[model samples]
Target: MTASHNWPPIDPADGWALILTELQRDLERIDPDLVMGQVKQKFGTLSVSAEASDPALADAVHGRIAAAEALSARICERCGQPGRIRQRPDGWYQALCNRHALEAASEMEGES
Candidate 1:
């Protein structure tokens, strides 16, 4: 199975984009008929949901998802640059560059 025709939209330049592309390639190699369901990012983590026609492919799919999530923690969501996981005052986590982090902090201060 190939990536779903309705896979969630992801910016081509985003770091997660590369991860997803690699995932698709790897999954296809393991099981050419594996159906990629929904691919999305939530709370700074990459979630790749898939349905494997064969139960044997389940472990491989889960391994790929785990690796991708680890990589996402080091990629800036806004600029696709290298970053570290940072928590905002409101307890939301994001991987961001210094500039964007400062900007977000300023915006939060303004809101207060």
Candidate 2:
């Protein structure tokens, strides 16, 4: 079984810990696996469900995604460069400058 302690690093300032904890409790009360199955089955199907207007649920989902995006952005602590991480096929992550990123993409295309 995977351990929570081994999970990837998360931003402490995002308030995700509290939100995630509550979500876990809610899932525990019901079957998370079942909920996931339902979601998968209904994928791409949008309906005006009973709880569609739930303000709290909307707020929670919005807050979490915003926090994640914020954490993904990095302002170079050394050079004051603002950038984000992009995944590489080699399994290594790169923090690229705007110019560097475009150049790298061009090089990869040329290689192909």
Candidate 3:
């Protein structure tokens, strides 16, 4: 039997530890042979690319990944608090709580 995998070693600031854990658990049950290829944050939400040999299994895995990504959009990447999407001066978006948003804005402006 193949060993179960853990969450991809991505940044933890996204408050996604729980989400990743839950996703891994469900994935193990739904598609044991499936493997997560890449996990990253894109456009203010979680993005997970998975690999699977079975087409039907792939669909199920993708569905689960979508669900996790959706959940991440509402969670603060810094503090795991409820959050909203905000855009940076660079035009990139991030899911952050009010306090983190303010801090990030200041940091972007070169403030300490």
Candidate 4:
């Protein structure tokens, strides 16, 4: 994905691999010459930046991004199992399943 004008540094996390792969494929179909920018997780959900020439194409690209984000919100950031957004004592948030939530909490406690 990066080779396209050296734009996309697409590094999908363990849980987001499948979602991102489908996203990439959909993006290519929408705009074959699309050049992607930084893809990050914002507010415990997927956030993506992409370049498009036509407004119509851009709108379609945005729709796909939104769809991917929606799907990711229900999945654990560490594993693909169903999850929800959790707030850390420090105010940080993440999408995590019940099993991984314990591990994350332990790590946070260690930091404290």
Return the top candidate by TM-score. 4
My TM-score estimates for the predictions, one after another, are 0.78, 0.27, 0.85, 0.86
Candidate 1: regions farther than 4 A off:
4-6, 13-15
Write the residue-wise lDDT of candidate 3 on 21-92 in tens digits: 788788888877776677788999988887764788888888988999999999988888999889988788
* lDDT string, candidate 2, 1-112, tens digits: 1212322343444323333344334433332221221111011111111121245455444444344334334522112255555544444454445765676677777877
Question: lDDT of each model, Cα atoms only?
Answer: 0.75, 0.36, 0.81, 0.79
User: Per-residue lDDT tens digits of candidate 4, residues 7-112?
Assistant: 4544556787778778887888788777777777888877778886567688898898889999888988788889988887678788889988888889889999
Where does candidate 3 clash, by residue pair? 13-77
Clashes of each: 3, 0, 1, 0
Clashes of 4: 0
TM-score of 1: 0.78
Which structure among the candidates has the greatest lDDT?
Answer: 3
Can you write out model 1's per-residue Cα lDDT over 37-93, one digit (the tens) per residue? 777767766767777768988888778878888888887777767877788888888
Report the lDDT of model 1 for residue 107.
87
Residue 16 in candidate 4, Cα distance off native in Å: 0.6
Clashing pairs in 4: none
